[model samples]
Target: MAKGQDLRMTQEAHVTQGPLTTEAGAPVADNQNSETAGVGGPVLVQDQHLLEKLAHFNRERIPERVVHARGAGAYGTFTVTADVTKYTRAAFLSEVGKQTETFLRFSTVAGNLGAADAVRDPRGFALKFYTEEGNYDLVGNNTPVFFIRDAIKFPDFIHTQKRDPYTGSTEADNVWDFWSLSPESTHQVTWLFGDRGIPASYRHMDGFGSHTYQWNNEAGEVFWVKYHFKTDQGIKCLTAEEAEVLAGKDPDSHQRDLREAIERGEFPSWTVGVQIMPAAEAANYRFNPFDLTKVWPHADYPVIEIGKLELNRNPENIFAEVEQSIFSPAHFVPGIGPSPDKMLQGRLFAYGDAHRYRVGINADHLPVNRPHATVAHTHGRDGHLYDGRHKGAKNYEPNSFGGPFQTGRPLWQGIPVTGVTGETVTPVHAEDNDFVQAGNLYRLMTEEEKERLVGNLAGAISQVSRDDIAERAINNFRQADADFGKRLEAAVQALRG
Candidate 1:
C-alpha cells in the first residue's frame, strides 16, 4: 500500500445490499424488468411499482403558466456594491459588499412550455433573493413597460396574445384588434416590434421591474424605485429572419445555450442598478410613475449602480428547482413593498393564488421556493401534502400556550393616501402623451434596425385576415411616426400583392 493510503480492512466493510427496495423499504424483485403480461406484451397494471411510476409520470405536469410558460433558470449570487441603507431598511441592501444567494428565471411570454425559445415575445425576468430576513422576489420582465396597466384587462389581453381558440394558432388579427381598442397597449406594442423585441439570448438582454416599488428606511422615509438588471454581456438581438430560422432549427436554443455556457465556465452576469424617485417627485412627475405602460426616462432619474449578479450554477434537477419554482411580487422583505402600480397591486394576489392552485397550499414547502432563513411562525397548517414541519407546535396565534407573538414594528411604512372612494378612472398625468416615447425609441434605432423592425411588423401584420385590424394597427404606428407607418404599410401591401 502507498504510504498515504489506508490499508486496514474489516470483515463487514464490504457488505452490500441484496437488491433495490421500494420507498417503504420492501425489497424489490425482478429489478431488471417490469412485471408485464409477457416479454413483448402490454405492461401489467398489477405491478404496483410500475403503476406508481406511470401514475406519477402522468400527473407530474402542473398547469402551464398563463404567461411566460417557457423559461430557463440558474443559480447565482447578488453582491451589493453600494450602500443604500438610508433609502431602504432591507437587510440584503443594508451594507456594502453583502451577498445573497439568488435564483433567476428568464422566459418568453405567450409561448407554451414546448414552444420555440427564440419567439418574438416579451421575456419574463424574475429573481428570487434568499436573504436572512426572507425571500425577496423581483418578478419583472425584459421590457421596461407592459402591454396593459390595469389588471382587469390583463386576462383579456393575454387571451388575445395566446393562440386563437378557433384556429388553435396565434392570429395577428386577434392581437391587433385588442391593441387597437386598448390605447394603453400602444407604448408596449411599439417596444414589442422594435429591435429589442427579439433578443439574441437570455444573457444578452436587460431586465426591468417595469412597475414602481416602494422602499422604506429605518427612519420611515419611503422612496419609489425601479430595478434594472443591465446585461454585462451587452444587448444583442436577432433579426426577424435569423430568429425564425433559429426557432425552426432549435426550439430549445436559449435553454441549451444557458446550460452549455455555465458548463463551459462562461457564466453570464448583469449589473444591478436602480432608478430611485422621491415620493414627492412622483406626485409632480410628467408621467404617471405607477403606470405599467410607461418608463421613467433614465435622463429624468439616472440609474445608480447597486451590485452585480453572476449566474454560475445550473440547476441539479430541472423539475424540482426550475419547473416547480414559484415567485410572486408579494414576496418582499422589510423596507420593500408594492407601489400604487395597479397591475402590481393585482399581481400581489394573483401570483400567490396561481401558485396555490397549481402547486398546492404548501407550495412554499418546495425546496426551490423555501426560504433559506428559518420560519418560526406560520398560521397556515394542514394542507394537501403537508410536510408536517410544524410538528407539535401550536397552530393558532394569539394563544397563551406559548404561541407566536406579533412584532411591534411594522414591516414597512405605508404611504399616505387621502382620496375619495368611488368607481372612477385613475387620474392621468398632465404631460401624458403615449406617442412621444414610442416615437423617440423609433428615432433612436439605427437605419438597419429600423428596416428589420419594419419588416418584422409588416410580416406579422400581413398575416391578419381582417384588413381593418391591420389598418388600425398601422394607424397606431402612424401616430407614433409617419415614416414608420408608411414603411410598414408598403411592406405589408407588397406582401398582400
Candidate 2:
C-alpha cells in the first residue's frame, strides 16, 4: 500500500518519474531479477542496477562524529522577549518581539552512535540560529562548567571516555587517572557523577553556552556574555538504577520520549537568558572570565531574560536533517564573536575541519545545514558534490566584476592587547583555585542530593580495579570538601565489599 501511494505520487509529479530509472535515466523492466548467463549461472556484466545498488550501499554511511555521535534534533522558533539592542547589534535580538528560526541538537558527550541515551555524560545543548544576518551557532552543554580549560587536553580527555584500544572496553582506571591528575576537571567531575548526570529527558534539563562570548553594540560598546536556556518543563533526573533499567529496556528512550511528545503536540520550550559582563569588568573580575572549567556566579552576573525558544516541529528525516546537520562556533554574525576561551578557540577550527572530513567539503550545501539567507561566496569553487556556481563572476576577490562582495563593516573595538607572544601558559589569577567552586557546588546540594551524588560517584569509582587510581580520585574530592570525600570513600568501600 505504501509503495503504491509512493509510485502514484511520483507518476503525478513528472512525465518520467513513475518508472524506476537507472543513473542514465534508462527505465528498468525487471528490478526483481538481474541479467544472467543462464538460470543457474552467474550475473551478467550488463547489470548496471545491481552494480549501482551494491556500490551505493557500500558508501551509504559517513563517518560518525568523534564525540556527540548519538543525538536528536528538532526545529524551533526563538522570539525575543526583551530589548537587547543596547547590548548587541545582532539582528535576531534587534527588537522586542522579533522571531528567528532555529535548530537544536541534544546529545551525550563521549557516546557512540548506538550508546544508550540515558548514559551518565555531559549533555550537549547546541543551538543554531538562522537569522537574517546569517547562522549563529551557540555550541554549548547542559552544564555551565567543563572538564578542562585548555583545548590541548580535549583530545586526551575524550580518549579516556572512549574504549581502551587493547581491550575495546571502557576502563574506569583511564577515566579516574586522567581526572585525578587534571585538577581543573574537579568542578565538572562533581556535576557528572551527581543525580543530574542522567537527566530524565533532554527537554527537562537546562542548556548553557558554557564559554563566555563577546557581544558588541551599535555604539561600539562591548560586553562579555554567556547564554542560558532554562527549560520550561523544569529540571528532572533519573536515579542510577532507573537509568540502568531504562538503558536495558529502551536504549533510545530519550529520543522516543521527545519524538512522541512533539508528535502529540506537547512542544517543549526554554527561556533564553544571558549573563552580560562589561568589557572592563572582565579584567577586574575575581576569577579569569575565560576559564571554561569555571562558571560566573549568578549573584555577580544576573541572568537577564532575552527570549524564548519553543521546539514545535520534529525532523521529517532524521538521517538527512539531524545526522547531516553541522554547526560551528565560528558561525557568528556581526554583533557576536568569540572570546579568549581556549576550548572555544580550538572548537572554532576543530568543528569546521571535522565537518569537512566527516560530512563533506560541500556540507554547507546540504538542505539542513544550508543558510536560509542569501549567500554570495565565490572562493569555494569546486569540490566533491559541488552543486553551486557563481556563473560569469570572477572566483578571486578584488576583481572588478559587478557582484556581491565583502562589506568593510565597523567592528566593536575597545580593548587592545599588549602582550608577549610565544609558548605561554594561562596566567594564574588570584582566584584561580578550582576546588573552591566545586566545594561550593557540593555544599549547595541538599542532603538527599548529596547522598545520591556519593552513591553515583562510588558506583563508578568502585569499578576501577587499581586502588591507587581510586584513591587518587578520592583525594581530588577530598580537596573539594571533607564531607564529600568522607561520604564517597565510605560508599565506594561498601561497594567493593
Candidate 3:
C-alpha cells in the first residue's frame, strides 16, 4: 500500500433508493447496532438483520472477468449522420439524425482487476446500443486483427497471460514461449510491440470490430461488414519509460483522465465508420476475410462514415452501472448478425455463457444491460436477482392463455456450409501465411517507431531463459521482415551481454 493510504474503505457517500429494509420488506428497527446481551455480554446469534448484512456483504463480489477485469465505462449517444438503410435495416442506422443510447466500456485484455491501466495491452472496445428493436452489442478491440483466428486456442493463449500457477507471478518466458511456438500469433504480436500498443489514453485509441459481421438490408441483401470507431482525440502513445513511470505514479490515470474530461464538458467522441464488402467478395479476396487474424485492407474497401459517437455522461455508480454492464455478440438485432469467423462463431455462445455464470441468467434484466424499448417476447425467468416482471405467467411458449409470442422478424438466407463434420484444424486457405500482413505492418512503421518496436521485443525476449524459444521468436520476426529480424536479434544479443 502507498504511504498514508488507508487499507480500510471509506463509507459510501451516496446510495440508491429508499430506507434500508429487510429483503422480505419488513422495516428494520436499527441498522447500526447488532443484537447483544445487555451491556457487553455474549453477542446474540439470533441477530437476523446483522446476519443478513454480513452475509450479503461477504457475497457481494462476483467472479472477476476471465479477461478484461479492469475497465472504465461511460454512457454515450450514437447519432446516425448518414443513412445506411440500404445496407442494414437495424433501427439505429435506419435514418439520418436518429440517436441511440449507448454504453461503452474500455478495458485491458489480459490485466487483472488491480493491474495498471497504462500497460502495453490491447484495450477492449465494447459498446451496447439500446435500439428500438433490441440491444445490439459491438464487442471489439483497439486493434483490428487478433492473435489467433480460432477460439479453440483462446484458453491456452489466456493461460500464457495469467499469472503462472506455480510462481503466482507473470513470467515473460511463458508469453514468448507460446508466441514463438504458435506462428499464427505473429501479426498480433507485431502489433503488441509496436508504437501504438501503449495508448496515451482511451480517448486517443481507435477501436475495431475485430471480427467480420453480417448485415442485411430490408430487401434481404446480405453484406459482410466491419466497424471502426476512429477516435476524435487523434492517435497517441506512451513510450516504455513514460508508461512505467505513470503506472507507478497513478495506477488509475486513464480512468481519472476520462472522468475529469467529461466533467469539464470536454466530451470525448469517435467518428463511426465501416468497411463494407459485398457478400460474394469474401471468396475472391486475397485472404479469407473471415479469418480473425487478417484484416480487410483499407485501400480495397475504404471506410464509409455513417455516424458520430460522443460520451457526455459518466456512470453514477461504477460498480452498479459500469462493472455490471454486459456486452455479447449474440445480442444482435434483426439486420446485423454474425459471420463465418470461427472466433466469432464460438464467441456467439461463449460470451453469453460466461455472463450467465458471472452475472445471473437474467443479466439482460439489469438496467445497464436491459433494452430501452419494450421486449415483445422474453424467455426464461426465476433466477437470482431477477426483475419483478412476468409474474404468474407461463414461462414456456405455445400456450392458449395469451402468452408471449414471437414477432415475425425476417431471418436472413442461410449460407451453405461444406466442411466435413469432425474435430479438425482450420483448413489452410491460400493466404493462410500470417507473415505477409505482419511484414506489411512492420514496413509501415517510421524509423523511430521501428527502433522502439525492436527495443520492446528485445526487452521481453531477453528475459526468456530458453535459448530455443528466443531463437524461434527471432525466426518468426525474420519471416515478417528481414531487417526487423536482424535488428531484434542484435538488440537481444546486446541485452544478454
Candidate 4:
C-alpha cells in the first residue's frame, strides 16, 4: 500500500469476492425478495437487511454542482521540460524532467448534470497536481478572458446565463440585457460568438489560467504569470448548426469522445507555456494586468514553453474520481501565490466553500483529492469521513510531548500595498477601455470568421423580445468596431424580420 496509489492499480483481494453480504459484512440468507411473513403475508419489520438496503438506496444521491455540473476527468502526468527557476521556486518546477501526477477535469460552465455537452459555453480546465510539497490546483477556463473584471458582478453575470426565475428557461432577453448593461463583457462576448464557442471535443481545445497569478523565486524576486495549455491535438471547433445536431444526437458527445479516444490508447496532451511579467513592470503596463476581462498580448510578453501534460489513464469509477473531485485556486504551493485579480481573489474563498458544502468537510481526505507524495499534518480533526490517522497524537501544538510545529516560512511572497481599503473601483490604466481589445479581436478574424461571428451574435440577439435590449447589446459590439456593428445590425434585422 503505497501513499496515494491509484485505486485501479491495487490488488482486488480487498474487494468483495465471496457470497453476497450486507453492508455489515454478514452473509445474506436471501437477497432476491424481502422476508415477508410466510408466503406473502404482511412484510416483517424485523428484516434489518431489507430496511438497510432500502435506506441506503434512498440516500444514494448527492447535490449536483450549481455550475460546471457536466464534466469528464482523466489521470495524467505533467513533466517540466524547461528550466524556470528564475521565475518561481515552486518545487514542482524545481528542475527539468520533474514529473508530477495530475488529474484534469473538463466541463461546461452553465450546463446541468443532464445537459448536453456540445453547447456553446466556456469549458472548465481544472487541473490538480499532486506534488511533494502539497496539491496545487489550477482551476481555469478554455477562454483566456471572462465577461466581468470584478467579483461583485459574478452572481449577476451567472444569473443571466442560468434559467430565468420567471421564464423557467434561459431567456435570451435576460442574457442580452445583462451583457448590454455591462460593457466589460464585450471581449468575452466576441469569443463566445466566434467559431471556438462550441469546442468539438475537450481534447481539441486549449486551456488557460485566465486570471493573472504571482510567482516568486528564492531570491524574493516576484513575477506575474499567466498559464496556457495548448492542445497537442490542435484546435478543433463546431459551428452552431453542427453543435445543435451533435447535441440532439448524443447529449454526452464530448464525454464519449474523450473516453473512447483514451481507450484507443490515443492519449491527449498539451504543450504547457506561461507568459511571465516582471513584478516591476506590472505597475505601468499598457493595460491592467490583473483585469480578468483583458488578456496581455503576446507582443508585450512572449509565452515561454515550460512543460508537457499528457492524459494517460481514465478513472475506473466516475463517481469516486470525477464527481467527488474538488479544486480551488487557493491551493498553491511555495513560490506561487495570488495576484490582485479581483475575480481570482473572490474565487479563492468561494470555490473552497462550495466544496465544503457540496462534498463533506473531509473532502481533502478523499484519495482523489489528497496529496500523493506526502501526508498532510494538521490540527483539524473529527469530521465526516475523517480517517483518524493521527491516533493518540496531541491535537494541540506546543505540548509537553513532541508535536508538529510550524517551519516559520511563508509559502508565498507578499506585495507592498497602500491607500485606504474600501469600496473603490479598479485603478485606471492608460489603455483600459473595455472595447479596445474586443475591437482588436474582431479585426484579427478572417472575413469568413467575421461573417460566422456576426451570424451567431445576430441569431441569439434577435431572439430577445425587447428591441431596446437587442439594440443595447448590438451597440456594445458597434462600439468595438463600426463595421462589425453595422454588419451585425443588418444580420440581426434580417433574422428578426
Off by over 4 Å in 4: 1-62
Q: Candidate 2, residues 179-248: lDDT per residue as tens digits?
A: 9888889899999988788899988999999998989999888999999999999999999899999999
Per-residue CA lDDT of model 1 for 265-300, tens digit only, reads 999999999999988888779998887888898999
Q: Give lDDT: candidate 1, residue 188.
A: 87
Residue range with the least summed lDDT across 10 consecutive positions in model 2: 36-45
List, residue by residue over 1-497, the lDDT tens digit for candidate 3: 65344323222322235676777777777653344343212223465665554444323336877888889999899999998989998888888999999999999988888899999999999999988988999999999999987665566678798889789888888999989888878999999999999998999999999899989998888998999999999999999999999999999988898899999999999999999999987777778787788888899889999999999999999988887888899888888888877678657656776777778788888888889865636657778788768878888887888987876775344565553333334445566687989999999999998999999999999999988999999999999899999999999999988
Q: Per-candidate TM vs. native?
A: 0.86, 0.86, 0.86, 0.87
lDDT to native, each model? 0.81, 0.83, 0.83, 0.87
Q: Which stretches of candidate 1 lie over 4 Å from their true place?
A: 1-62
The better-scoring model by TM-score among 2 and 4 is 4
Q: Supply the TM-score for candidate 4.
A: 0.87
What's the C-alpha lDDT at position 411 in model 1?
69
